[model samples]
Structure formats: C-alpha cells, structure tokens
Target chain A: MTQRDHQQKKMQIRDGFIAGSPIVMGYLPIALAYGVLAQQSGMSLMELTGMSLLVFAGAAQFMGANMIAFSASAIEIIVATFVLNFRHFVMSLSFVNQLKRIALPWKFSLTLGLTDETFSVSSIYRKQANQAYGQYFYGTLILVAYLSWVFGSLLGGLLGDVIPPQLSQSMGVALYAMFIGLLIPSVKKQHKIILISVTAMIVNYLLQPMIGEGWGIVAGTLVGGVAGIFVLDEEENT
Target chain B: MIWMIIIGMAVVTLIPRIIPAFIVDFVDFPNWVNKWLEAIPYAALGALIFPGIITVVPEQPLIGIVAGIVAIMCAWFRLHIMVVVLSAIATVFVLTL
Candidate 1:
C-alpha cells in the first residue's frame, strides 16, 4: 500500500480502538464472570476459552454455561442459543447502510464479531462521522472487544475459584449498566425511544415467567419494535 | 460431547449474525422493514436490561437497581462510557461494603 493509504489505515485503526475502549471495559467484568461461572460448572480452561473465542455472544454464552451446568444435551444447548441470538439478524440488517462500501470478505469477517456492545458503539461512531465505516476502524473495534472477551474468560477460568464471592458477584451489574449507558443518549435525542424501551422492558418482564428465558426478549423486541414504527418522531418526519 | 456443544453453539450464533448481513447486501428491505430496523437497538437493549437488571444481584437486588439508576444518570449527562461504567461498579461496591 502507498504511504498515505497506510497512514490513513493507522488512523482508522486508532479510532476503532478509541471507540471500542468502553465496550472493552464493559466486556471485561462480564466475560470474567462468564469464565468463572463456566469453570465452576466444570468446564476446563480450554473449553471455557474456546467458547469465548468461537461463541462470542455474552447472553448466549451465559445460557450455554447454565445449560451445561445442568448437563443439558448438546442439541438443546445449541437450539436455545440459536434462538437467543436471533436478534443478531436485526442488528446486522440495521448496519447494512453503513456497511455498503466495505469489501465482501472484510464485511463477512467483521460480522463474526458483531456483539451487542460493538454494534451500539460503532453505530454511534458511524452516525457522527461523515464517511462510511472504514474496514480498519471496524476490524480494530472487533479485534479489541474479542480479545478482551477471550482473555477475561481465560482469567475467570484460572481465577474463578479464588476471587472473593462478594466482589465477583458485584460485577454482574456492569453489563446492565453499560447497556443503560448506550441507550440513554438516543432516548434523549428521540423521546419516542423512551416509550419503545419501557414498553419492551415491561413486556419482557411479563412474558418471562410464562415463556421462559430467551423468548421473552424475542417477544418484547417484536412488540416494542412494531409499536415504535407507528409512533413516529416529528423530527425524523420533516 | 463437549466439543459438539461448543461447535453447535458457534454455528447457531454465527448464522444469525452473518447470514442477514450477506442477504441484505443483495436485496433491498422495504420501508417498514427499515423503520423496524431502526428501533431494534432500543427495543433489544430494553428487553435485555429490565427485570433482569433487578434480578442481577438476587441477594441485594436494590444495589443493582441503584447501579442502573447511576448508569442512566451518567449517560444522560453524556459522560464517557467508561466513566458511566466505573461509577456504576463503584456504586455497587460501596453499597455492599
């Protein structure tokens, strides 16, 4: 590559890292908990880390660990996780406009790392910038978030048993905090967001006892999303 | 047997994330689809956070709620995400002390 192109690439990568820092921070404690939980549930270090490496979704990983703890069959675990991660299809399709200029191979590889945290952070960045999402920018964000997850799992696998009970348990709140942070600015910008989100939360809560784990979220997402479309914001309309 | 579970989880998770992006490149989504897509993040994050947040710390559910309120405040003020996260963690730590 030419000198200027190389310099641009470096800058984009740096931006990606900066954009991803909060997500990395957020992922660290949760992934650590996941690792610890997996280890306590009888997974080896390799199995724990391998799951982190290959199946990077936080919610699904937790579900898998819980099911494994109960000795759920492999097919049952897989099917449950697939249903849990079905929201990724919505996330991916939402990102299509920003991802248009990216090459096919890079786009495909980058999608592999499309966790909830990365999607929210990168979407905010893409909205603010005049340009399309650069390959290096997207790739670096994914790489850093992915590594933090893997390493956090590894640490948990190694140290899960040793950590004080209270401290590790406190880390459970971090992921929810991060998700709250991600949603606040948007909700502020568009008042309609508050309605959609609150409705979804209520629906999820109401459905949880009846429908069980993952499906509640699915039902909530569909109801809230459909409800949101009809409640158009005045700002976007003009 | 463990290997089977790991591979199975990997394939199922990857398919939802990867397949849609590939298809979207080829086909155009209708306007209603676009509108629903826009709301996906808000709806998904909402569904994921609530009720679950209350239960995150089963022993002291109040601490989780307090931390979540702290997070909402920080984000509302447009503080850095790291700051929001750190402060929430600190809230939980302090309450438990």
Candidate 2:
C-alpha cells in the first residue's frame, strides 16, 4: 500500500477504537455480571471465559448460565440460545448490506463480533461518517469491544466476590442506558423512529408473559420493522 | 456436560449470525426487503430496552425504570454515551442505597 493509504488506514483504526470506547464501557459491567453469575452457577472460570470467547453475546450467555444453574438439558439451552439470538439474522443481513464494499472474508469475521451494541453503533456511524470508512474501522471497533468483553468476564469471575453485590447489580442498567442513548439521537432526527421503537417496546412488553422474552423480542422487532415499511418515507432511508 | 451445552449454544448462536454473510451475496433483495432490514436495528434497539430495562432490577423494578428515564433525559440533552450510561448506573446505585 502507498504511504497515504497506510496513514489513512491508521486513522480509520484509531477512529474505530474511539467509536468502540462506549461499547467497552457498556459491555464491561454486564460481562462482569455474567462472569460472576456463571461462576456461581458452577461453571469453571475456563468454561465461562470460554463461553465469552466463543459466543461473544451478552444476553444469550446470561440465559445460558441461568439454564445451566437449573441443570437444564444441553438441547434446551441450545434451543433457548437460538431463540434469543434470532434477531442477529436480520442484523447480519443489514450489516453485510451496509458494508457490501468490504470483502467476504472481512464480512465473515466482522459478523462474529456483531452484537446488539456494536451493530447499533456501526449502523449509526456509517450514516453519519462524512468520509468512506473501511473494514479496518469495523475490525478495530469489534476487536476492542470483543477484548473488553472477554477480559471483563475474566475479571468479574476472579473478583466477583470483591465487588459489593449492590454495586454489581446496579451495573445492569448500563446496557439499557446505552440503548436509550443510541435510540434518542435517531429519534430526534427522524420522528418515524419513535413510532417503530414504541411499537416494538409495547409488543415485547405484552407478549413477554405469553411466548417468553426471546420470542417476545423477535415478534416485536418483526412487527416494528413492518410498521416502518408503511410509516417510513423512502426519502428518509437515504 | 457443561462443555456439551457450551459448544451447543455456541453452534446454534453462530449459525444465525454467520449464515447471512455467505448467502446475502447470492440473492438480491427487493426494495421492501431492504427497507425491512434497514428498520431492524431501530426496532431491535427498542425491543431490547423495554421489559429488559424494567426487569433489570427485579426486586425493585422502579430502580430500572427511574434509571432508564434518567438515561433518556441525559441522551436527549446529547450527552456522550458514556455519560448517559454512567448517570443511569449512578442513579441505580444511589436509589438502591
């Protein structure tokens, strides 16, 4: 690569790190909670960290840990995880389409790091970025977030007892708060987002008791996406 | 047994995430399909927050609700995401104390 291209690449990676900092902040406490919970549930430190390394998903890992604590069967845990993570299908599709210029190999590796937080950050960033950002931006973004999650889980597993229960428990609000932060900006720019988001929230709330939280999220998102089709203007998409 | 479940969960989870990258190259989507995919993130973000937020502090659901509202207010003011999150965490910590 030329000197200018290399410099640009470095800048992209740095920007990615900057973009990833908030995710690092958001993922740490939750990952820590997962680590503590998993350890308490009889998972060895290796097993819990291994789950973080391999799965790299927050909600599903927590759910998996809970099912394990209850001695739920392997098949049951797997099915529950699939149900919980089904939202990723749409996310991956949108993410891949968003970065269609990036190579297939990069897309595959990037998708491995895709989570609710990273997807939201990247989707929003792509729209607002004035210049063309490349895969290195996303690669760095995902890497930092991934490392924080794994490291935070390890730390929480080792120091779970050291931290006070109330403090650790309070960290649960961090992820939701981050979501609100992500949603509010877009809602300000485009009023349609309010309707889509509120509709999804209401549907998930109503359906949660019946079909369960996993299915509730899936159904709510689908309903909300359809709501967008009718409500969102074609011009706003650009 | 734990290993079995961990591996199983990993496989099932990865399938949904990785499959799209491979297949999306082959099939072209319609305009509406693209629209639906574009809308997924907003909708998913909403679904993730609600119910999950209220239930974050199961014993005191009000803590989560109050924290969530604090987050919304902070975010509305265009504060940094880190600030928004920490404010909510601090709110919860104070409320629980």
Task: Kindly report which residue pairs in candidate 1 clash with one another.
Answer: none
Worst 10 residues of 2 chain A by lDDT: A124-133
Tens-digit per-residue lDDT, A99-209, candidate 1 = 766777777888899987787766666632334347788889889999999999999898875657676666767778878988899888777788888888999999989
Superposed Cα RMSD, model 1: 2.4
Chain A TM-score vs. truth, each candidate: 0.86, 0.93
Residue A88 lDDT in candidate 2: 84
Instruction: Please tell me what DockQ candidate 1 reaches.
Output: 0.71
Clashing pairs in 2: none
Candidate lDDT (C-alpha), each: 0.81, 0.87
| Per-residue error (Å), model 1, residue B13 | 1.1
